[model samples]
Target: MVGDSSYGAMSIEELVKFFQTGKVVGFPTDTVYGMGCLLSEDCVAKLRELKKGREKPFAVFVPDVDSAKELVEEFPNYINSLIKKHWPGGLTLIFRAKKGLPPGVVSGEGKIGIRIPDFPPLIEAMKRVGSPVINTSANLPGEVPPVSHKDVRVPLELMLKGDSKGGIPSTVVDVSGERPVIIRMGAVKVFEIEAITGKTILLSEGNVLNILYVCSGNTCRSPIAQYHLSYCARDLPLFIRSCGTLGFSGSPATENAIKVMEEIGVNLTAHRSTPISRELIQWADLILPMEPVHREEVLSLGANPYTILPFYEIIDLEKIPDPIGKDIEFYREVRDLIVKGNRWLEKHLRERFNP
Candidate 1:
């Protein structure tokens, strides 16, 4: 009704009414073209028939957080954190299904995947329908899902003509397990997930090294090391973050730290300090701390002893001192030290990750 003229067009209100009455419709999503219907048994059966008898559990499209909450069993704090950061976008979270969902809504393992899609009109339609809809890619199983409404092969009662910001499918995270597991890697990267929940996430793709750099305030040493190493090892399979053991959250990197990094063409102006958290310590495959005291703090936060390696100790270099109140020259010296350490680390990571 919105764009393509091949099919019968309908107003959004009419579309909502059709959905409420269990008619399948095709539409654009933030990620790709999709077809959906109400979660009623007859509607789900028709949706499956349209997809050529595919039987994989379909993701439920919920309009809002409250709607999502009603469909799943209780979730953990980290799941809530991920929802806060990634919802209304291209991330689908799977949780243990609560009882009494429609037959096709829950997988055999009793888990249900749900997403609050970024598309405004579709979300509004679901909100108006007052029930979750069964959403699946707009193609037969094993076929490339359509990115535009015109490319859709499956016939529907109506196709809401629109464009899809197609890249990869939504990233799927399963929180029904003892730990969060990434069953599918799509639009969202592993590093972005780690930044939000501070838990190292392994993909079905393979292993990825996660490094957490720590310092006193996160404004000087750790930021320098994090940015320098990130720039040097841009292609490696690594996720890097910096935090302060005894630091203020949301504090910007010092002027000296920013200026020194600029000399080497690495931008530190965007770096903001975050205090080291238990989630962060748990997330790191390797924890590189600026000083021995920082390493001790990381250990105090329940980090594995094997994971906490002081940077100077590991590289056999003298400890890089903090340059908070020091002159620009001192900051430059610190930057040089971090560069030397990062150079050694880069070569080591290259050998290990082979990226």
Candidate 2:
């Protein structure tokens, strides 16, 4: 906080020196202007007191994602995906804290919020500091967090310049729980989170491979293939779903295909169809198409055909016959072919996604 040594503004070199001397300063984060001090009890106490000692915990900001993992117990799998998607942006993720952080940051909650600020100089300063900063917004308690440097309330030895892009604060989530709980919905939306995470928000048991099956129409082959593959992968952590290339969003799986899948121990009675989406394609580590046509569709979405290759590529077939409106035996035959095709898929998966 500013004091007798108040500096109107400081160069990056001066800012680095301020941090080295155990001083708190005002700076910009991607979300808003921020107040930070070197990670130490005495410095944090000074910062917390200056910032009005608000009840909740402060975030510990690292230079980057790897630094974040260093101060936490375990970084979940989905969290790594999120870090890739939104680091250096407005997203505060809570992880179970490791010791050595200031008590004020953890606040005896045994959880510490981690942020990787998108601000360049701030990130550079953090890199040089070689430690985390007690990253909290620059404001008095219960006031709007400052986006522009002009609005900073906490006194500082120096101020970093920038108009804070203040639209929404960083979205906050606690991944230290059994599921990711949305504690605050600010910059990122639930659907966007789901798109990147390949998950329905707050509805998960643990990390799983997101597999999407693509076909001409969702009502038959794709659903049957995914359900059967899901059945085979029951012991593995895999989330399987199907989509159609024709934009058939709500059709049901053909009755014969559903019945045949049931014979194999996968229940498709509740399967609902979805259309192939850019979101789904992005979400999937592997986009498996039932035919060459489906593969082309996936490739049009900027997908690499190497990843979305047709299942029959393994079985030496030109195409996997669509068994829509077919008798149960024909459906059963296609199911058997798909079951064998998965062996090729397993090998390719190990070489490609290896998830």
Candidate 3:
């Protein structure tokens, strides 16, 4: 077993040799020690064979969100949103696998668990290696995970000493759903991870809630509210959509509005102006409008069953302002107001929908 010391002190050549040879090395993570091998078909096979473990499945640890994105296929916007809020930390997300990864790694489940450790040594090693590393606990099957290198078994110890730069285990968080659920509570506290991801780590299964926004023209306030709500309701599996009262269909969001949103890191360039329709109104559980008049329009379409909330009421309820032909500065002010309103909406949803 590797001794409890900073393997980070070793030269890069030594670290590279160890990983290339497909040896499982113990490294420190933000939470605990982790055993990993190079993430490739051959290396994965060697690690599994060495562990004498079943093809149950395995996770990969990346150095950052960009790397995770490269590895996973068809990652949804919600997944990107989660990474924006919680990665470069201790959260682990399971996503559909892309073509490059070996099927044995994820056990042909078509999904893979990925993590980005916060520790420097592992991060440096990953950066140097230019790919993900196989992540599993540093222990034999049915054995308790080792808390430190000294706790690793004799055979595993030799590999750690031979190859690992800093064999530390990473804290694991499973985000394969609307909210994260902790399978094992380790180095990172559940609340801490939840705070970053903005999603509660559920202990049991439950329903996912959806929220929608509607207005006359998708260009102005509705789409803005949709994106802002996405940030505020980052914790819930809330579905956010925006449509206009009239079909300008295929029109781009106004340039000034896009500028305002981009300031807060929301890309509205792809937002096409979609008009409000009976089907849309019926599809929504809650239809928030920019003004009271717009709410009436939605209600007239038999959308009355869905609650009609004012943008300010759901977001800042008291500060809804007009944004038509406004200056970039005016749009910025409106954007800030919407962000505040979404915060209020978040609290409301959590209290009302949380089971």
Candidate 4:
């Protein structure tokens, strides 16, 4: 609507032709205006060039439920109920991707976001094209998404006319994992989704807490504690990192530590030691050091007293002694202690975050 009459006046036949030729179009969606082209290697490349430097994976708009079902690897059983209640509205669902989707439409973890929009004109255009199309919000990175046809600034081979609900975007729920996580809350209310799913939706990202675990050599206790809680509380909004007060950076976890963790089903083979620094201390919402001396060391480097706590004190366990250079049996003892402490930590996180 904001463009010159000549450019905005493209017909449906012309729009379909443009899609065939890998050109993008702007159209109104139930939530907002969106710009995209039918999915293809060339089309996705062009779309990526248009939104230069943006890294978030694009969502694809399917014409109907059947198209969406074909796009994902396998639908979760609960998804049928959610679709029955919310499809053709403002909900974008993420599922494990079926193979052969172009990289631009698939997340790094190989998931795809698929939405069946309520907007009739867009649906008609997709049906004509006979495939799903990239449906990213019609704006560049860091810019507000256009709510009306006239607000759209991207160049398009055609601009389809329709009324969007405006203001709020669609709620994005990732069903790719064991538990569904709401990555973005938008037009649909959380309680509404909860009511349909009959389960509490964990918020995956907003207001996340950064937890830093510190030990003498990041090789052992801290990494054990970090990885254990990370796997146990994977659904919570917490970012876990570990470092050592006295250990060298980039050092792998000691062989015993890695072997012992594997016995308990936690992987520590890939962990590299990060030496504690002011930046890390400042980044943490909570810093759990292996012993009182490590806490004292961090405090000397200006960590806030409230944010830094000795692991023993919080878990009500005896101080974790350094197991560096110790035998494999000694390392196993240390790993068990960290595992017990991490169970306490995981409970504390769930109670605090209400996930």
RMSD, one per candidate, in order: 11.8, 9.4, 17.8, 13.3
Each prediction's number of clashing residue pairs: 0, 3, 20, 0
Per-residue lDDT over 1-355 for candidate 1, one digit per residue giving the tens place of the 0 to 100 score: 4434222324456668778777888877889888898777787788889988878888999999999989989776776777886788889999999999887878999999999988777777787778888899888777898998888878777887776875468988887765567777665654567557766454544556689999999999999999998898887767999999775899999999999899889999889999999989877878998888887898889886756668987668667788889999999988898898888878766644331
**Model 4 per-residue lDDT tens digits across residues 1-355:** 2222122325556566767877788777778888889887777787777787567788999889989989888888866788887788899999999899888889989999999887765676678879888878888788898887778777765676654675579989988865668788676655456656766567665757679999887888899889988888999888999998885889998898888989988898889999999989877767999998898889988886757668987657668977889998998888878878888878766754565
- Specify the highest-lDDT model's number: 1
Model 2 CA lDDT for position 61:
80
Clashing pairs in 1: none
TM-score of model number 4: 0.57
Q: What TM-score does candidate 1 reach? A: 0.59
Off by over 4 Å in 3: 1-11, 76-86, 157-182, 189-201, 204-355
Ranking by TM-score: 1, 4, 2, 3
Please give, for residues 201-223, the per-residue lDDT of candidate 3 as tens digits.
Answer: 55333434445677667886778
* 2 versus 3: better TM-score goes to: 2
Q: Which ten residues in a row have the lowest lDDT in candidate 1?
A: 1-10
- What TM-score goes with each of the models? 0.59, 0.55, 0.49, 0.57
Query: Which parts of model 2 are misplaced by more than 4 Å?
Result: 1-10, 203-355
- Between 1 and 3, whose lDDT is larger? 1
Q: How do all the candidates rank in terms of lDDT, highest first?
A: 1, 4, 2, 3
**Candidate 1 lDDT (Cα, whole model)?**
0.81
Mark the 10 consecutive residues where model 4 has the least summed lDDT: 1-10
lDDT of 4 at 317: 62
lDDT of the structure predicted as candidate 4: 0.80
